[model samples]
Target: MAGYVCPVGSSSPHARSNACPPGTFSNHLHLFDKSQCETCPARFVCTRGTGGKQKPPVPCPVGHYCPPGTKYPAQYKCAPGTWSNRTSLASEEECLPCPAGWFCVAGAHVPSGRCSPGHYCPDGTRTSTQFPCPAGTYSTRLGNGRVEDCIACPVGSYCTDGTSKPTLCPVGTYRKEQGAKVSEDCVPCPGGYHCPELGTVAPQACGAGRFSDPGSASCLSCLVGHYCADEITSREAMLLAMVCPAGLLCPEGQAVAPDANGNACPRGYYCPRGDIVRGSVWLLLFTILSSSGLCFWEARVESVLLLESLPALGCLIFLLWFP
Candidate 1:
């Protein structure tokens, strides 16, 4: 036949050249039936041959796939991010990427699954090993199809695992450093400062003479009868209480004192209540002077003065008689 070739190793002259078999082909015309035909190998095909020559199998080209026993060029192409290697790949399923944590090079006979914890692999990767996710990025899943799978750490969160999602920084804590990988990377708000919410980059300082508890949202004024020293931290403010001097008067919510040392009673003044009021001092002085017979002049002075004066007048009369 014009388009047929004899099979290889056939000894009979009557054996006519025939069309190539599904898995085999010959390029030479008038070839002895005894001539050996070429067999298609995996991932390869032998679709065309001349009448007088043997044809070599052609490698399956890119964008097309050839299964074992294929006598013609493949009509199917590999799926995106997938590849096949070697001849005789029977199906598209045979063309696969290295499993999670591993990588497979082009034409690889076996997949590599040896990637370390911090590394990852994408589909159709040709390297024998995986590449690391870049800083500030992470991947928690295995067998990532591409670098795009690596996720960026959120503004308030941290990520460590190459194949995992990021974690949020806790309340009262902050992380200024980029690409923080763990909660430990977050710093606690300092004393006298407040970190009200999560992911704070810096703590907010309490206002002057004001204090806040740790992680407080707002600062508190010093309590009544209490004084907050300047620049005092929250912890110190809580323990501080203002005390008035022994002799001075102190009222609630007194911030500045006209005389912090206290108002002292004058030397001549007797402050019975420890206060310098004029009424108490006068009342005390009057009571003391009137009780004694020291007042000699006015009847309004007292009973004691009357008794003593009468006795003195009688004595004077007796003295006059004796004279």
Candidate 2:
């Protein structure tokens, strides 16, 4: 006889709201209501049971599993910290750590990928292995891409990773302070001093009376007859007042005296002033005195002859003036 189906949850015949259709509830239909069903506890799938259930036994979906505890409606999830390449029909294994120099950002789900070049993480975020240090710079310490690893200037020179050593001024040059890592820091020779070569040493002075010019190898002497007053004070000043004053002839008799400028004439020489005639006369007397007796005798004969030759010569002789 035709009959009504059964209702959920009631064990009595009243639970059937209607008679089962030929195909309906033919499989394991253990639970009267679909709502009462649950997925297997995490690694097991549903299987046919004694009762006629809404669905036949089924396997878990790919990448996922149905655990043992429940039967139908719900699906189970993978265990925490565990993963599988494809859907899992069984329990999952724990994920492994990424290899060195690599990172696994998504934990169990994603694969490890290479770290970016110029950057490294030996132990994930805990340590770093930065790229190579630049030329002229070094990092004996760890380089985590931070500023601390960069080198700095030493006592006498400076830099900001711009160059290796604090630039050494060439041999004959100097810098005021440290951190000068370039040629620009090398200063020129000091006043009155000179340095043909460039470098870190203080400029040498063209000592007293010497003239030191820039770019020259050594100091030069002041011209003759000129004095180098305050010679040591300034070399360029050597040119000043270097000439002898006019009228103050650098006398021939005496070595030319280096005026107030420090000029020194040879000894036995005197620079006299006024008419050269008087000077000539004095020079003549000196010449005569220095001559031999024969020269004196000859000079005497000439004078006597001239006196006899003229009447005026007689007048001049009485005046004690004989030419």
Candidate 3:
């Protein structure tokens, strides 16, 4: 009696052979030569054997996946941040974390997507690209591609001309009075004190006294006993006032007044004894009253008497004799 061949897909196949392929086997019930089959259809695997004839088809092994475009079984690799395509995969692995201040767009894939350094994307905006920090804003903090925030300069500070942030204009330092062209145009401080002007130079002395140094914008107080009376004039009053003649004194009893010339008594009325204290005012009045020469002779004689006796009585006598 002849034995019936099993189906080709079952464990017990129709044909059998001792010379099976490395990845295939044969069964006992044979209707045709197993070595003659060159290829297997879908859902089956055929192994190479002697002389290009492949082994009989067998079901694919479990836990292995063959996606399109892959030629070899060893080319299979799991993607980052994703699960492997195998049911028997025991452990889940994650991709590397993105570096600080940087953002990763593609996870665990070779040639991963990334954002440029020193840039960020704001909320509601796509994070595929990086945007640079705008003028008037700055940040020292680390960030990813998602950072869109930057710090602003405070009041009294400005970063004109597209600076990263505002810088301070120091105290006592002021900008140019008008028509400043650039930060350098801010003038050096006036005389007495110093400060950084327009973000340069440390503070320094401007000049002496409230009078500012020449060509400077700042000022200082006058030195003791010396006065800066006006924007242009110097208050050297004592020096400017007239010096009395060798023996003459001013009629006001003071050696000096606004004028430098001593206040000598008038011609008709002499300064009694040439004493400024006893007869200055009277002599001034008498000199005006006796302008007609009426008291000229008596004024001379009274002047002689005053020189001998410079008392108030002599001054009264001189006043009485006035013409």
lDDT of 2 by residue, 132-180 (tens): 3243343344223343344544433434332423445554455555445
Compared with the true structure, all predictions reach lDDT values of 0.51, 0.38, 0.35
Rank the models by lDDT, top first.
1, 2, 3
**RMSD of each predicted structure:** 19.3, 21.6, 21.5
Tens digit per residue, CA lDDT, model 3, 44-161: 4434331122334444333233232222233333332222223322222322333434443422232233434334444222242445555444444444344344454333333333
Q: Return the top candidate by TM-score.
A: 1
Candidate 2: count of backbone clashes, pairs at least 3 residues apart or interchain? 50
Q: Estimate each model's TM-score.
A: 0.40, 0.33, 0.26
Q: Which segments of model 2 are wrong by more than 4 Å?
A: 1-161, 196-198, 215-217, 223-226, 229-235, 241-323
TM-score of 3: 0.26
Worst 10 residues of 2 by lDDT: 302-311
